[model samples]
Target chain A: MRLGPWKIDVEYGHLALVIVIAGVTGFYLADTLQVSRNINNIILVVPLAMLLLGLCLLVVTQCIRFRKHPVQKRATQLPNHERDELEQEQSPMDLLHAFLLLLGVGALVMSYPLIGLDVATLLFMIFALLLLGVRGWLFVPIYAASFTAVVVGGASRLLPYPLPTLLF
Target chain B: MLDSSAILGAISLLGSDINIWLVIIPGLLIGLIAGSIAGVSNTMAMAICLPLTLYMDFLPAVMFLTAIFTGGGYGGAVTSILMGIPGTTSSVATTFDGYPMARKGLHNEALGLALMSSVLGVLVGYIILLFVVAPLGNWVIRLGPAEMLLVALWGLTMIAALGGKRLSRGLIAGGFGLLLGTVGMNTSGYVRGTMDIPFLLDGIPVVPAMMGMFAASQLFTLVGSQFLIKDKAARRADYRRVLSGFLSVLRYPFFQLRGTLIGVFVGAIPGVGSSVGNLIAYAQAKRTDKDPDSYGKGNPKGVMAAESANSSSEGGSMVTMLALGLPGGGGTAMLLAAFAMHNVTGGPQFINQNMDIVYTIIFGNFIQAALLLVVGLGFLAVAGNIVRVPLTILIPSVLVLALIGSFAVTGDHAGPITLFVFAGLGWLMKRYGYPVAACVVGLLLGRMVESELIRTWQISGGGELAFFLGRPVAMAFAILLVLSLLQPLIMRKFTAWRTRNRSA
Candidate 1:
């Protein structure tokens, strides 16, 4: 990962992500330019153009950096010890856990409209506890249920409107 | 406006009302506790307690809610400093330096600084509000759409300055955020970026998005850590150190005053209030400081500037609410509701006819400001213990709060969904060298800038250049903007020249 006294340790996956994001933004900007000349459209186009420019520059710079540091291109595939010493070790399990928690949160949100707030919250809380590395099956339900009840119950009483839910 | 009879009436009204005194402490305590929690907002606390106001007399009801407002103003700083999760938008900039200070084992000091600055800010804000309620209203109204647009632009320049070493990366993140902000429907009935999603017609909710980016993403970064502060000794709260931190604010009276001024003016502006005020004050404090580079890296003054500006904005926002009957934001909206419940109307006529009531409210706020000093110290002492909580428990618990909080914001699933999506984006941005702060700033200013720009264009009949040229206030703001953009480079070059001269 060391290239001419500069240490670069970006993974290939992250680099590809940068390219993808930049490409999407650039595409959006081009599409927006063709829309119109109204005040609202112009307002939208200016910042979108600026954003695309910034993203393109970022992608170009990152590409140039990678080009300059050919040896660092395969830093993600480095032998374990070398990678560990150079970059703070993030295990694949840790990455998976984080990603799973995120997915669980998304699921929790999407399920709310389907089932209801109360049920969705109860289910999500338990799922979140598991994803967050909570153990003891007995405590999980107890904690999730009570937490859901308090939040959902409080919102029901205090907020101006009833929180949408299928099952109370 | 300041007739002796009015002053006497105000004093007598306040003195006769034992009920007003009774509710102040309890209301403040509720606010402090609710605000101290990561997801619980002052507005939420007030909303929960709003029904209680229905039973009380008019002055006591308004006084009670205002007490909660004052206490909650400082309450958000606790978690922002300790956990890097801003309990409210007002405390967002506080996270920049305050959290770093906490990580460096100065959590107690940051809390004390925030509290003291808040107390002073509220005090100064009320004092200014008392004298200039009418005049200030007239003055701020003179700000045209062009001027307001410049104010938002002024905020954006800070993004480049916010990016520590990677200015370009910060600009990229900020630009992306600006683009993201424009995703929903525009004022002109055109929806550009919302892929035909029905809910997005109203645009992405800013508060939930903010919580996900700053709070949840930050928690993700802190995974595997047992304690927030790595230093064991720094983890414990020291009362003496807290006292020392309280005393530290006196050393920078000018900084506090500057922040107070910024807060009052910005807070008076309807729609854009304390949220923008705090950021602008922090940026100004950083830009003017001798060691501007030290800001956002555990600097005490940064905490002072943000807290002072935000707290003082309460008084500024009140000016519009009381004198103009315009609710500035959520908290003030609650206050306006209280006014309605009391069978009172607040406008120019209200001030003219009910000067006694106006004086009483201002006087009550002064008392609340004094009480904040005492109640806030104890609250800080207890809230500072958050560092001792292990990450395993703290993370899940805060996540729960954040989820519930987002849910409360929209009273729908949209809030949590936005939080989850943005949390992932924020995590990745943080993982890279992109300045999340810049993106946040961009997100906040994006709508305001565009709206103002459109308004200016409409007012000018498409002659935007000539309109801006005619507006002296906008011209002044433009000059300020150019100076702000050039200041850092100018300072750096000046310093280099001085260094060369010294060496020679």
Candidate 2:
């Protein structure tokens, strides 16, 4: 189940299943190879199997352990002072900012190759402006124009960019 | 003297000369950017830039990477101070108290402490590398597989030493890490775990895995908690607080020296580096303090211990790189990759033959650290304001950059996909309390150990116990490994007995 400050959230069950599948598939592949019991190879395989098994075992242990102790009950009745002290470890603002940043970065990454770097930068800038709660098309073009200047001026001079051709 | 100078002239080369000012600024700038973000490590920055270096001349490329290295070192302190999330492994211990200080609005003091510690750590580590690396390089070059194995084992055992009182978990993680590392290839021409995925033939790329483990897991945690957060902090942000905070570094050199020594020694060891060093130093500082309980509760000493020690380790790790032809830490490994690309053979005689380039590296470290101190302080003063950028645009753009950063290496979608794959696995590992970094380090050092073992085994015709343990130096290291593995167990039993006796 839960170990110390770390908990094996129920959601990781899917991941555990995936690992099990991977392990089995790996075992199957090892068998399929039809390799003889070479000492060195066995030395490698045995450890790999054990490590995977250990990971799976640990995950399973977490799920089993926490099922016996719900989060609310555990938090309220915790005997240890340290665990009690860690009750409000994460703040909402921290999580939100991280997600917003993650989402923004994810979107920009998926779109980069489709549009050229400059266009991508301009569009991402608009999206970023929106994330910052700034509404207005006025800043959009200004953002693009300023970014374009920065990109062109900066890249041509300061950056070590390779083969960044502009599509007129 | 002239002949000596000629040889020195040949070796002091850093790389193909590039625009110095342009490179350092960008390097520092990117490092600052990356370091300020949680889970984006200095190593990730290096890996992302690895492919880019193939195109540039050597020195500029090296300079750029070095800049990122310097900048990344200080950048981690920002997130550690502002948010609980460590921008790097090194900064993890800082979160014990740094974030609490920020929450109390002593943000300037905490930030200042972090900056000072970082600069001091860097200065000390660099100085050590300058004096120690060249002298020891000759002897270290003679370290065979046996010695290297001992060194690797030393790194492996650090988990047990620093894992708080939970020594069993640390040992289990470390042992399991070694096992995970055993996947894929062996020195005897056997590919045990390949199973047809050609990508795994070379074993797992620890960098991508590390990113997944450390970076992606944090992302998943962020995602899981999404939509529950409210926007606060409508008050005006101040830059002066950031400046006065940085000025405090000059005021506290003792903290710097203590932290630096701890960091450098930890860093010099082959496998471990800033994170472990930082944690150990912080804990030690706490244990020795008059008010030990003050730690993990907004103590300035906590921040000083962690930040200074973490930065100091960077220099120690470099010493291993220069003297022993060993990569000190993950960052040094990246440096090694760059050296390899430049045909820079850095074994025992490297410095003797090429003092200029060698000295340049040492001097470059000082210059890099000096520049990073200024850069980090300046950014810490202003980076808080960066939060206002719209998520919509910044998200998509950064995503592109991250993807490009990944793909730029292998030149395929595989790299980005690999990044995500690592991220997904990392998420699972974190949720289940699996030792993420331990597994990665195990995997990273695994192949190297096996390769050497097999080489040594074959070299000695079946690796007889006598041949393996024959050399005195080799025997010494092997003895160290045995003791390292046993010490924790002995200490635990001794403590338990003492407690029981006292109870009786």
Candidate 3:
């Protein structure tokens, strides 16, 4: 896959996921073992984490082997063809849209307490709508505000706990 | 098991109360709304409405709460079918086929199947409860920690089936979920994965994390789509298709029966309720089905199996609460609280002394189940319109609703934060062909798996292999688990042998 001057391999994403799992599991296992070497305490965590780590290693090895002999693997495997076909079907722009939507959701959640649930929600709505190609300046804000009001207002009244909000 | 005097007493009690009859509709509606929402759970809905039951008499209050319980059971299927988001944990399996059906422009049928299955599940569950509440309660109580651990393991087997063709990815996702599930404090006071977050002490909020993984992550992937159903012509909510779906459930009576039975047995066990019951039922359905590959790809039988188990599990959970005074799960716990409020204790004594009241509750649920068919039909008419909404509007709106729903669940920023974090992980997993459903199941059962294992170990006096041999129930479950795991292979071999023999 190419983007401007950069070449990207989608296989790296799979490898990255494996690494994240292994890293998190390893750190967690170390922390758990540090807390206690008792069988009762570590029984589940130890074996499960080790299994996960082992699986991660297995995945990493497969990725490395595949990369090392891409041509041979591509020739032998049928799933690679299917996967490549699927990759072709999904445009780079679609990936960008997904990434941007994720970023938008993250920002909304992070700013929730500071900016208030209502404001954060409003901004997120507008951002998301525009990002998803909802045009017209007046229509976007109107939809965002109405949605925010109904959800936030109803939530405030119905919920036992108060929601943090700068605007009603 | 059938007491004539109790039956007479139950009939008289039910006939005497107009208030009880009146509360059933409202209770069902409340449950439906609460259960259909992205983040709000049935238990949460019941808890919120617990106070309102104060003004009513004991019978009415109990009936109302149970009504909500029954309603919420089916309500979760609505969102699960129309959108990919399961309104409650129990409905997770519903999304497996329900969402796919929705995407295929068969949302009406899916909704209908879910509704009919849920109704029948409730009815069958209550009927079983009516006859064998005492025996079932006794059977459930005998199940020790080892048995519970086996049950959790049974649920975990679902990961293998859910993995699709990629067994390795499925195992990795499931293993990662198990690790994530154990992030908070362990049963033995060992905390490992909290990372200093306060909420981590209790463990990651399962509901919020679940919403993140299934709902938000799914929404992100839908960014490129114009609508949930891409075909504009197919997006119409046809009542005829809905009716067809409803009647179609009868075609798989055995599947529905199997699911209901699984739900009852699984639901009867304390702490393991509809959530595990639905998954186990779905797994069994998939394992037994001739066309297993059709599952998770808009198979109506999958929806029926899941809905039946989850809805019927409500009745199964009620067995412990009614006969043993033990709450099987959170919703039953709320019912027990209602029991306490009325100065009523649930146990063998309660059942022995107040058989009439027990019969009344059972009979009342029968009516609730029947009424659900009518109420659910009306509810679906309104809720089915969700498919018509364009993705441009629906995606962000649902995402925001999920965030708020998560916030409502946690009552703090932790919920929203967890939602965002898990959403990213869910998206990555989805992108790379890993099963997010497997991960969600792992996370859901992770804590239970650990606690039950620890208990089993303690009972065995430092994990002695001999300890399991002494327990026949545990041994039986182990055998069942082995058989369940190997059934696919055995079936394949048997088929091959027959084919070869035929050729000869």
Q: Which candidate comes out best when scored by lDDT?
A: 3
| Per-residue lDDT over B1-504 for candidate 3, one digit per residue giving the tens place of the 0 to 100 score | 699998999999999989989999999999999999988988999999999888989999999999999999999999998888899989988998999899899998999989999999999999999888999998988899999988777676565545544656777887788778888888888887788888899988899999999886578778778888978877887899999999999999999999999999898988878888998899889888988878878899999999999999999999999888999898999999998888999999999999999999999999999999999999998999998998999999999889889989989888999999999999888777788877887888788889999999888998898999999989988887777656656877988999999999
TM-score of chain A of each: 0.67, 0.49, 0.81
- Stretches off by above 4 angstroms in model 1 are A1-36, A63-96, A112-168
Each candidate's lDDT (Cα)? Answer: 0.80, 0.62, 0.88
**Candidate 2, which segments miss by more than 4 Å at Cα?**
A1-36, A51-76, A80-168, B1-27, B30-69, B76-111, B160-187, B224-259, B262-310, B313-367, B386-404, B456-504
Clashing residue pairs for model 3: none
Worst 10 residues of 3 chain B by lDDT: B157-166
- Number of the predicted model whose TM-score against the real structure is largest: 3
lDDT for model 1: 0.80
Worst 10 residues of 1 chain A by lDDT: A64-73
TM values, all candidates? 0.89, 0.67, 0.95
The lowest-lDDT stretch of 10 consecutive residues in candidate 1 chain B is B159-168
TM-score of 1: 0.89
Alpha-carbon deviation at A71 in model 3, angstroms:
7.4
Question: Candidate 1, residue B325: CA error in Å?
Answer: 2.3
